[model samples]
Target chain A: MADEKPHCKVVLATNIAKSLLEEVQDGLAKIGRKPLLVGFLSSTDPAARVYAEWTGKTANENGFAFELREIDREELEDALLDANNDAAVDGIIVYYPIFGNRQDQYLQQIVSIDKDVEGLSHRYIFNMYQNIRFLDHANTKKSILPCTPLAVIKILEYLRIYNTILPYGNRLHGRTVTVINRSEVVGRPLAALLANDGACVYSVDINDVQQFTRGEGLRKRRHEVHEKPGWTLENCLPISDVVISGVPGDKYKVPANLLRDGAVCINFSSDRNFSPDVKEKASIYVPAIGKVTIVVLLRNLLRIVQNKIDAAAEASRENVSEAVQTSES
Target chain B: MADEKPHCKVVLATNIAKSLLEEVQDGLAKIGRKPLLVGFLSSTDPAARVYAEWTGKTANENGFAFELREIDREELEDALLDANNDAAVDGIIVYYPIFGNRQDQYLQQIVSIDKDVEGLSHRYIFNMYQNIRFLDHANTKKSILPCTPLAVIKILEYLRIYNTILPYGNRLHGRTVTVINRSEVVGRPLAALLANDGACVYSVDINDVQQFTRGEGLRKRRHEVHEKPGWTLENCLPISDVVISGVPGDKYKVPANLLRDGAVCINFSSDRNFSPDVKEKASIYVPAIGKVTIVVLLRNLLRIVQNKIDAAAEASRENVSEAVQTSES
Candidate 1:
């Protein structure tokens, strides 16, 4: 299997191994493309008493072999920089905790963009801009779309939303969505992406909700720059058709009690210790944000990874091609 | 003044005349800085026409001065590339048309970051992400804020919307804003930015809108990926207290007839002409779509542009500095 070309491989990067990651890896593996669980483990996942047993359980349950590996934090960035097609990695899955100081920069510093599992890197975002304006398809194989954003599309799918809901009044034309906690990696980046998908975007800082957008023109009272440059928690919340929140450990912020009644909330805010209260309030909470729609993002991620090896390989191949071309010329 | 010894000189590229360009140049011309306009139209500006022609009359009386030159269309991109401060041009303006083909990529390409007039390049946007997560200043000059976003900030100066509005009982935020187009020139990127600034962002595309985010949880939607995607324009409209629109041209299908009465509409749509009905309805149409704010935009634009040049210069200077240090050592 390692020698053969992969349809796609999922490189799951996380703080620890979990049943969801195993289920996904096994599910894909059964279908031929397995997922690599790159996470913090008590031991080698396959050797760990629990996972080794779970691996057998999950693999048999899904009809394929599940693989797991532990990655050193110090080596992660270096490994990312040096990754290539022959490098034994295909896609990437990042399951990280929100509390660490280095977590944010580390995630931002080296997204597995070259071999990105999801198109969450700067390059992919740039590619998205290009695709929208220039209609050019780039990094389709190597670009990784953020899973949360893809999940939003999935939510629309759950409701059976489609193009027919146009000319203004139906599904969500002229819609505006304000994302709280813009820095919550998945939520903020995903918001911009959702807007690009065709929704109007109202992004507010989770902390300083009104720093960028002051509520004027509309009926809301927003502060002036001269008076105060920040927004309080009160200035942050507003009526919305739906909410996609990933700010965890703050159940009070997204509990059933906090949401506008009837407003659907999709919780991507799950951690290892899933909260019953949070889940109860959430319209839906899942281990994977959205699966099928991730195809586009996955393809983009593969392309970037492939290109790294392709560039070097292509460079050497250029000599042979040049010889052939020289004769023709 | 053009010939005077300069601390530094950066090029200003815009869609306007060289004279108005010069006024900007003169205002910013201090001991170590100079702004050179890429193109100059002789007959228009007051500073250029009279140089001191009194009364400030007739609105068209003033002619602008300063260094100016115009380049042809095909050569425009090339001029920008040449102006990329390889030690020749300091910075570039690369102005957008009052109304023309989307100039986002064109703008990004010319921005060159630190040398970016206002650090409005793709590089800078990602840099902002790093800053958001790390709380580190971008370390470039102050010339990087996009003009439109800045204007919005300036608008907040007088209004103080955040201060006036009270958040809801559920910690429900006040107003939400939804901007439709994500043209790099203005739209999705801005939305993403606003997300970082902190607003709940619910981005939607035409199809996503058809799938209104009405019912269900995040996971329930995640599980429904097989369902079709649809969208309605109204679905994308902000349900919050405020709505800001920056879509350019007539193709923007935001049905004005559907706008909820009392919703403040700030239109950035310009086609050199407005329908009689639109003229009747708009509460405020910022003439030239924040063109007056261009000067402020220029402040960032020039800063980024100079930063790029300075960065390059510094890199080279470091080599020299290294050599000197080596010699001393």
Candidate 2:
């Protein structure tokens, strides 16, 4: 009887990422120039080095320029400032955890908002959390979201998790999601994004579980959070329609038996947060989303370039209007 | 049998506000000068006018200078820029709903961060939501909170709702709060603040309810939000230790029967949001917190002045260090 049970479909991010990469390639072709993305590397971590290599390979192959600048941790700030001022640099991203303290956070703020491809700056973070979609008052420019979280959202959409029949902002209405991890960079923002789209999200962390929802309304800019004091993974898994995990520890695993039958499961952690048997219970499983995340980073770079071009065009139009007015006067 | 039950204690904001006002007075005396707070009024709303009058009176009485600048809605941007440049103005507050849309939000961003006594600027809002307590990297300057929400926290503290035995940042641990309103200015920020302090807050609005909480960890910078699907006032009230309502409707009321026995209740709405019978169920009932809000506004003004002084001193010290380094080189 157990052998007769259907194994869940395993989805890889490569195909999804390839299509998105094609879209980026098309965008770059229209621009007629390779937009330079400068990557700041100050960490000795092998993982960071590997990620940088991958980013460079992908960018160079896909009609974009990628430059990796490896510098000492102490000189990273000066390097960042130079990158920010460089006319050729369209976007900037730094491999984080250089100092692994509040100082690292300070360095994030050092990246200019205009060129910050990582979207870690205060302005972007604030806009994302507040659900402000546009950068300008007139809504001409769209605000950038952090790439990793945006990657998760894109994957979910690709998996047909977001219902298309529903209205634009409330596409995930009636969906119940459980997100494991509360990290500021990835997990927290992912949960917020899910909730903003109208999913009831159980934001499970090491300490406790919290529920994130937008409540039934079109006017809500962002999701709301509620604390679930005594809730455990066991408690959430049984009720969750979708389970997303990003716990960074290799030893940590979400027990497959705990998941609701036919529930969709996704993991974004570098370390496996789910066991091999997750497919037995889950209707769909995404093993990794790193490829999608990289493409999203490239997408953000393109957006930065587009925003700059738009601003310049707007400025020129204003200048022409002012000149005409001055001549009449 | 219900007749024997004791009526709850009625807590007034007057005494609490008086003490806080004295603290502001002492702060001004130490500074040896009054900090001027400029209020921008473009709304024809009577409530705005009365509030402005109250602000002016309270500010003058508490050793602070207040100026109400009535201007056309169209000139608000220029007026805000003028106040931002004015050296005499230590703080600036704008009466909201001037344009009653996204434009009003734009006006909020127009006030300079240094002179934004209302704490509605992007920097303060971002800090508040992220639970970043300091204005600067060195943690010398404390970030400011919006006045009305700060008043709610102060009221809760006065009621001894915060457990002193618990560690700082976790004093509101084990508490369940329900805040009925999700307005950007007060309800949402108040929920975030309480959750950051380790309380389980169910943030309710006209459309729906969401829970806000910081998972049990000292390292958690801000509260995570969760959506509560199909949750109602009846579902939350019995579990909540505190019920706070700021619903701006004359007929709105929190049914006394729904609240947990001996629960604390507070209403910041202009209209009474709770009935007289609520005293029978509540341990403490606070009908208003307007006085406390005004004093908090004044306190924010003092903080702006202090932050400016600190920045100037730090700049001078840096200059002295640079001069010494130049001579040595």
Candidate 3:
């Protein structure tokens, strides 16, 4: 009895990442190139160092090239620009927590949209709307989505397949998904992506009430009345089929009883957003594995960008053929 | 009984349009310009003709310039380009249902994003995401939202005050808004806009299931799992706080029994989406008045574009001052 393992199915994020990395390598090799990603660490943050180490190791094991470099805050722009201009660099990712009190969001624009593996550029964020338009996956070739959201999606798919007892599979349609964080990096984008997939996404946060839950003083701001509903963590988690939290701390936020039976719990925050007993309560629990998710995310971006590049080349060939025909005639 | 009027208050869409127009005219006048719009009617459809006529009358009554031109199908692009190039033409609107069998979606792109008063351009459409970013209202000066959605928002605001019987005023936060159309011109954007504000938006349509709801064959299309739950016309109407429909045609689509008492009904379709008896059941009913909404929309767009232009000018002035200071130093 002491040796018996827990009854719940435990899914490994690294396994997901490894499978996706293989697919990406194959895709890049088909295009006569190796998977090359440049990781820029502009700060000495502990989290940043860990990510850089994992990325370097993963790249080596998968027969790919990963360059980890430390760039000063002032040189950050030049480093990104060089990567952008380099024909060999397939993708560029900047580790967060750059120097000073501000986020390094300004650097996101320096990376070419085509080579933006992090999916932080305005174009990528904007093009994410294409999903809502129901354009085929091919149409979304214009911009890559952020890694965390993409990882959340993959994990959800994984849970659907792994949890055979649950009636609802990977399909997000009609699934009540409650996202506990409303951040730009994880929670907000995940909500949008999930909603686009037809999931009833309840994006919950502590500060969502004044903005989402109650209509008030909507006087002079006529056309600006649009605000997303905010649900408290306690109220929304109970009803959620899939509960995802990205709160960036070590505290256990989600209670044991909050997650109903057969529910799937996913944490993106490096810190645990769920209680230790959550694994025992829920049908499936996906703990935060940033390294695994990042690998998978970069792989997805590589494949998407390759498709766009291939399509462009094909279009150019067609144009050349048409010009020759017209000239001959 | 014949002499007794219903206890409900009648909300006129035109009043809202007129007030907005006044504000727009004042805004333009401050910039030493008048509200000038050119309406290009490439189709002789009765609805298009009606819109053109109403636009002309409203422009003149508001001490603005409105020019209505009937152009050939082949000349549509040229006319739009001319308006785009013309400094006199502050706004350009092409009536729907152009000479072609298909909707003239291509023409939407021809209008520059800045001059696109209809908010049809891809850039403007994509940028509506700013609301999700919680950017201040002043920041949204860059893009104009689609007219129908803007009008729906305005109507909701109007209903908030007009429905004095209800304790909640003009705020849409926390309200469950059900949009009964999935078309880009209305429902989809409306849902995004509403959800951006704080309302729990339920986007419904007849065929949303086969495409957006069910997630089958989601393997190769990992990123393409676009699912929007399709709530049949019958199922979702009962739970909505504000029910807005853009289903075209003359027949009524919403039955009286579907709406809960105190629900607000809004129709953007020329034909009734709600049954005739909806007025009796709902606390307030706002019928689609295309002409009035269009005026309000055009006014809102004019103001937004003017603000952007003014903001740019102010920025340029500051830049020039800074440049001079640098050179002197």
Candidate 4:
């Protein structure tokens, strides 16, 4: 619904430093709002990319000005956390390697859910799955919906995917979406969100598919294992209309045998060399690596701030008036 | 700050019907703002309490109008859920259950955090904890908080039991507080909130605590147990400092020798009168059956609403405008 308007600012936090982010922050600053930036090391940036959209994009544009910062290892645990809270920064962005102690401690210290522009806080992500509306945290939510997920609904609507059912124009209502990968950023939280959205969703880490089991429950449950041949074609081909692959490899080998007829395929990889036979058979393709996430992040952040802005303002006004009355007395 | 001078409309929702909260709801209505009561119920009028608040005492005196209705479970869920996307409601409220489901699926069925009134949405609650800034569904944010928890806080604050800490603001900061149950309405969420508020919170369930090792890591961990004690404290008499017990009956006993010096004990079951010695030695005694929760519930709800009232009004206006656009289009 938020479309075609002039955007105020956009930032991209990388696994570099605040100083480094500042070097490139000008691109966002040019958008007429003060840009906030943060950079980690290259190893940390990929994981950080998932949440970058909100921090990079969703912020208060009115009188909105921000600065960039770069942080390191020891900083990830105790010290950097203090900076995150103490900086009184409007928003924070982090780009770090997808793994390691740095990532874990950094996550612990990254910031509060309210100020987490990257939306990396586990609490933030979990609540998104819960589907409650989140007000103060920009781009994060009661349900862990990123712009990509919401966009999926919009795209479904645009395409008018006839087989799907929409609940009052909500996209995720009745469709079945099976996501491959169980990383913190995508698989689990997204699946939770889709389930909350009323879709029958199946999330499996491709790496664990070898142990797939058809449990007594309605849907087949499976353990994830990478490199199991039958796992790809046998597990997903028959069930899902949409297959979202969030693995990093540029070219994933899926025999046409595994591509369900007219299934929509979303690739969250940067590899352009993906085989054509796959795309030729699939209904659609979306590369989530950089293209879709930026927009989604911005939209999500906007939703968060927009949700609560007025109430905070009013409360402040009330407090002011109360103070004034007491002063008069 | 949202004293009785202002007027506002509100909605209420819960697992139980709104009727259960009539007295308190009615009192809430009598406060500063003109009130509107909206509710969701499976059978009874849980929402009526909210109605009683808005149209109750103060609102009734102010001659402000209010409406109350019990919506269908499915319909209400659809309206509140982003997945279903029913976008008509303005604000949503939910009552506190002393003990109930902790999974949050039911809570997720409420409106998106956007229109959610009490800030009970999981993501919204986590978000609120981070910033400590209250937010309204659409516009303003003030001190709107969860009613029951706020009530608990009100009592604690009013009583001045917790003292100040140097940097973090109060003694609650980094203090190990353990909640023994997994109540979405109270136990689990509240512990998380306190931790987010800078307390060192240990949200211990029976499963976790029962499995806990006594040395090293947990040697100093806070222990909060809710299950009826299998073994009597008659054997283990190392008394702790703070005991907030929600267990029922006097079957379990706290022998005079079991309590540490200056330990503040909160007992939910007050009928089984404590020995005068036990009462006299204790620094604090909390009668948990009702007293604090009732008044706190009302004031907390009021704070949540008032803090963000101005912003909410703006959001309401915006919603109206959007509705107009929808009509025109």
For each candidate in turn, give its C-alpha RMSD to the true structure in angstroms. Answer: 26.5, 26.6, 26.2, 24.0
- Tell me the deviation in Å of residue B66 in model 3: 80
lDDT of 2 at B234: 86
Tell me the tens digit of each residue's lDDT in model 2 across A1-329. 01233335678889879878888888888888889999989988888898999999988988888989999999999999998899988999898778888998999999999999999999999888777888999998989999999998888777666655344666665467899999999888888888877677899999999988764332345777889888899889876768999999799999888876557788999999999888666656889999999999999999999999999999999999999999999
**lDDT score of model 3?**
0.64
lDDT by residue for model 4 over B278-328, one digit each (tens)? 553343455452434433434444444454455567789999999999999
RMSD of candidate 4 to true structure, Å: 24.0
In terms of lDDT, the best-performing candidate is 2
Q: Between 2 and 4, whose TM-score is larger?
A: 2
| Arranged by TM-score, best first | 2, 3, 4, 1
Interface RMSD of each: 21.6, 20.6, 19.0, 29.5
lDDT of 4 by residue, A128-239 (tens): 6545545336633243254444444434433333212122312332245676766665566655555544444566665544222111111212212223444543665545
Off by over 4 Å in 3: A1-7, A100-103, A129-142, A161-170, A209-231, B1-329
Give each candidate's fraction of reference contacts reproduced: 0.03, 0.00, 0.00, 0.00
Q: In candidate 4, which residue ranges exceed 4 Å CA deviation?
A: A1-68, A76-79, A86-88, A102-109, A135-165, A168-170, A207-232, A272-274, A287-289, A300-308, A320-329, B1-329
Give fnat for candidate 4: 0.00
Could you tell me the lDDT of residue A220 within candidate 1? 20
* Reference-based TM-score of each model: 0.36, 0.51, 0.46, 0.37
Tens-digit lDDT track of model 3 for A208-245: 71121101111111111134554465666665657788
Off by over 4 Å in 2: A1-5, A217-219, B1-329
Error of 4 at B249 (Å): 66
Poorest 10 consecutive residues by lDDT, candidate 2 chain B: B1-10
